[model samples]
Target: MFQRLFITHPASVGETYFEHMRASLGTAGKLARASAACLVHAIVPGLCKTTGSTAIMALHSEIYPRRFDQPTL
Candidate 1:
């Protein structure tokens, strides 16, 4: 059960548990930073003009190369 809970999905995505954890945490950090930039932009109107969108696009590009439909392990 623990393996299914912690390992199955990551293996399906071609990542070990630790690798998936690191990648997901890094993505979460990027999203948090982007959100903060957007909030600041909302108040300033001139700062971080493309920060949020750029970050999101970069993330999308990275995920686009991965095949979620195929099980790797």
Candidate 2:
């Protein structure tokens, strides 16, 4: 069995959000990390720093890709 995950977001937010994620999560974090990453990351950017925290979720799929650079191994 295999799984794949799709991560996307609007490009309207400033790059700081992405940079924060790149710093906090690091590249490899994406693997063990959950789908919640998308929403969690987006929360700060979308909320304009008004809020401090958010809840996220993960979708389990048999064909979801674990990493962006490589397909499920």
**Largest TM-score belongs to which candidate?**
1
In the range 25-71, model 2's lDDT, one tens digit per residue, is 65345333533544455765553232222221222231144324433
Instruction: Please list the residue runs of candidate 1 whose C-alpha ends up more than 4 Å from where it truly belongs after superposition.
Output: 70-73
Count of backbone clashes, every candidate in sequence: 0, 8
| Runs in model 2 lying further than 4 Å from the true structure | 1-34, 46-73
Model 2 lDDT-worst window of ten: 1-10
lDDT of 1: 0.90
**Residue 39 lDDT in model 1?**
100
TM-score of each: 0.85, 0.17
Candidate 1 lDDT over residue span 1-73, tens digit each: 8887898999888899999999989989999999999999999999999999999999999878884675444
Poorest lDDT segment (10 consecutive residues) of candidate 1: 64-73
